[model samples]
Each structure stands twice: as C-alpha cells, then as structure tokens.
Target: MRPPNTPPARAVSTPAADDTPAADDTEFRTLLDRLSDKATADYYNPFTTFDWPASIPTDELWMSPELLSCHGTELMDELSPAQLRTLSRWESVNFYSLNVHGIRELLIEVTRRVHTPGFELPSEFFHHFIGEENDHMWFFATFCLKYAGKIYPDRSVKLPEAPRDPDIENFLVFARILIFEQIVDHYNVQMAADRRLHPTVRHINRLHHQDESRHIAFGCRLVRLLWERLLDRGPDEAARHELRGHLGGYLGRYLTTSIESLYNPAVYRDAGLPDGFALRKRLLVHPARQAAHAKVLHKTTGFLQRIGVFDARH
Candidate 1:
C-alpha cells in the first residue's frame, strides 16, 4: 500500500473535453440516487436490531456444514459428530473475526476516497456505505467477543508490491473490496437460510446479506466504470493487454489468499485439533476444498470477467 500522504495518480474530476455526463455516467448517478434512497429507507440501528441471546448453544452447529472448510474432504468423515459441532463453533468465530478485519480495512480505503477528487459523484452514497459498514464491523465484533472471547487476529500476509499507477491502484482497491464482499456474501446467503443453524447465527447472516446486496451492486458498477475510464485513456493494445494480465494475476492471488485465510491454524487449535498447521495444509490441497473455493468465488470471478478486468482466456 502507498504511504498515507501519497496523492492520487489521476484526478477523476477531469472528464472528456466536453465535460458532460456520458450515458454510463448518467446510469451510474441514477444507481447512486436509488441506492442511497434505499439505504435511508432500510436503515436500522444495529445496536437495537438484534436480540442477542444470553448464550448460543455449543452443541448445535454454529456454521452450516456446506460452508465449512473441510466440507467435502475426507477430513469431515474422520471427525465425529460432536467434534464437527465443536469445530463449527471455532470456525464461526473465525468467520466473523474475518468480517471485522475486512470491514475495517474497507472502511479505511473508502473513507480515503469518499469526498476526494475522483469520488464526488458517489460521495453521497459513500456516507451510507461507511455508516452501514461501521455498523457491520461492530455487530460482527460484538458477536465474536461476546461468544468466543476473542476476535482472531488478522493473519493475512502482505501482498506483492502493487503497480505504481494511480488508476490501477484505485481500481484494485474497490475491486478487492467487491471480491471480499462477494465471497463473504456467498457464505452469508447460505448460513442465513440454513434452518439447522441457531436463530442468532441466521439472523446476523440475514441482515448482513440484506445490506451487502446493495454494496455489491454499487461495487460492481463502480469497478466497471473505473475500468472503462482506464480504457478511455487510450492505452495502446499492447498496454491494455498488459494491464489485463497484471490485474488477472493480482486478483487471482488475492482470491487464493482469501480462501486460505479461512483455514486458520488457530481455529483448529481452538476446536481441539492437533497439528493445526499440518491439517490446514492438507485441507487446502484437497480437490474437494479447491472445488468449494471455486464455488464460493464463482460469482466474483464471473463479474470480473464480464467487466474486462480479467481476460476471458483465463
């Protein structure tokens, strides 16, 4: 990441010579207006929204079986039913902890751009986005600390050095946020509807999915607009191809890393499993787990391809 004091590479305020809203720009503004209004209408006080139970039963599954990291692997068969339930508890805590960290990082990134030069058009909705995400971070952390006694410390490693180009940097920031939300929403949508899980678990997941639907919509449109703007600068075919390749490589690594983070050794240890690190490594390479990761990322990868952020050949 660039130093906090670094200036944006290009100011988005500069438009084509005519400086009029293009057709896509008009559509984007329309979306902003509609989504902002929806946010206002749908707003709730997260503080009072959930009737958090005194205790969530440890005997019941805290996470859906299908969403578990070991879901399709032979590891699942090896674990007894009681052990699976225990594992779900730690896994659930780990999942919510990830949300807390993810929301924090995204909030910082979005805040930096909220009212800045290139972000004037969406700044209005950015208020709603920031507010809602803050609420999300709070509720997720509340759940973790209230039940599990700790929010798992963020274990994600530093990513490879990013390109120095400001445009690519901006695109990557929002694109990564979108990818994170999409992958999370995949689990949210499933767990929210799974009757087997506790009502408290289902309720939080349901509420998150409600808000994330809007955020994801906004993110998709914004990423596409940014990519189009990059294209409008008229990079040569070779440069455009290179940009695509770089973006593909970066995003692919991000996707893999995101999946791997779910298999935390701490989660295994908390669940009373031995050799947590070895187990995590084994689970990651299992063909079934790879397929599960693909399923989780399917919507996100498809969206990137549609927006030309990823080459179709990939």
Candidate 2:
C-alpha cells in the first residue's frame, strides 16, 4: 500500500513529440554521449578498490575538523582535543551514512524515469549514472559498517508530497539530485585532499569525487534543460512568477534540510556530548554555522541562480 500522505504516483505519459522538451538537441546529445564514454573508461571494481584497514585509530581525525558541525563555534573551545577527535570519528560515519541514504533515494527516482517517453534521449546515460551510484552506495555503506560497526539511521525528514505535474516532478527530481551531488562533492573534494586523514578515508573520498564530477556535470546540464522546458510552456506572467517562486521555495527548503541532516543528535550522543538535542538546535542557527552552510552551498546556489531556477536576490 502507498504510505499515508504520499502523493499518488502519476502515470507515465508518452507526450507528443512537440509537447515534450527538445532534449535531443545536438549539444545535450553530445554531452550524454561524452559522459557515457567517460563512465565506461572510468569504471572500477569497488569491492577491490581499497585496502580496508582492520581499524582506524580513534585518537586520529576521521573527518576534517573544519567540516564538523561545531567547527568555528564557541563549542569548539569547549571541547577538549580528545573530544574533538571523538566527534570527528562519529561525524565521519554520519557523513558516509548520509551519502548511502541520499544515493539510494536518487537511484529510485532515476530508475522510475529511465526509458520513459520524455526521458528516452537520456536513458543511455541514466544506465551509467545508476550503476555508478549503486557502486557509491556500496562503498559508503561498507566504510561505515566495517569501521564504525553501524551505519547511522537516516535522520532526514520526509519530504512533502510531490506535485502531480510530471514536468514539475521531473525537474524537481533532477534538481534535487544535482544539489545533493554538489553538496557532497564539496566535502569529497576537501577530505580527499586533506593529508591528515587516513589513506583509506582519503582514497574513498577521491574515488567518489572522481565519479561525482561526471555525474555533477550531467546533472547541471540536464537540470538546466528541464528548467528551459518548463519555461517554454509559456504560462502567463503571473503563472510564470508563481512557478518560479514555488520552485525556489521548494529547493531552498531542500537545501536547508540537507545541511541540517549533518547535525544528527545520535552522532553527538555517540561522541559523548551532553544534551545532544539542545546542541543540535543551537548549533544549527549559530552565526558561524550559518556562514559555513552558505560556503558549502555557494556553488550550488550560484548555478541555480545562473540558470534562473533561483532569483538573483535569493
């Protein structure tokens, strides 16, 4: 049975050729073909890719210090060096856990649309995307389970019901995927380059970053294409304004939710911090943390604004 409050699934329609977006434009087709080739050339066996150490040292940093939720806050001064290290360990696990959960959600959404009428042109690249993401989920989950002995439960709030309009739904899905990847790639790029982290930690981040580059490239182009299609529908000025406001609002909330998930209470409890809930609440709104969130999302928001998915003032 469909879950309560879930939006009813829309039937996939084979819209008439003229009704659909020109997704087969020469530029888009070239991008898909190039990315598909890159995916083929870059394929690797995840199971054998890394030398998983029997254990990572608890005293060492598992995650980069600056990426921690409490970084740059007064709370940083309150925690001892040992406490900071412990926090980093659990936070690293939490980060990977988020990746596993996020990748799973995107995979399901993409799988639903692949080979469907409006998506026919990009279905080939979808195969590559799906395979690569499945591999990512595996490695991330493996890292968490093998080292931490547990993957943190996904703490994200359930998203609101999706709009019944298929074009809107499709645009939102790809936009969400792009935003998620861009946020994750920010972390991946940082950790992969931080030499203080363990080699295994660095290796996984580096590998994920490599594949994510291709995925992000594809996502940016496809999201822009989808947005263009929506605009081409020629709604009245008021309707067009409403559509833009709705999309901007939804994506803004999504970005906030994604950032908040990084501050899991369970991570705090495991790290030996008292009042995990209160700490989460306070840290979420802290001036420094707010700035950090903006930095993390800078690239994503810039892209969205450039594509007109977001207003310049937003």
| lDDT of predicted model 1 | 0.87
TM-score, per-candidate, Cα-based: 0.95, 0.93
The C-alpha RMSD in Å for every predicted model, in order, reads 2.3, 3.3
Q: Model 1, range 1-314, lDDT digits (tens) per residue? A: 11112234444445446989878878999999999999999999999998988889999999998888899998899999999999999999999999998888888878888778777888899999999999999999999999888999988866776778888788888888998899899999999999999999999999999999999999999988888888777569888878788878888888888888899999999999999999999999999998898899889889989878776654
lDDT of each: 0.87, 0.86
Q: What's the true lDDT of residue 198 in model 2?
A: 94
Q: What are the per-residue Cα lDDT tens digits for candidate 2 across 86-166? A: 999999999999999888888888888787766777889999999989999999999999999999986687667667787
Candidate 1, which segments miss by more than 4 Å at Cα?
A: 1-10, 13-19
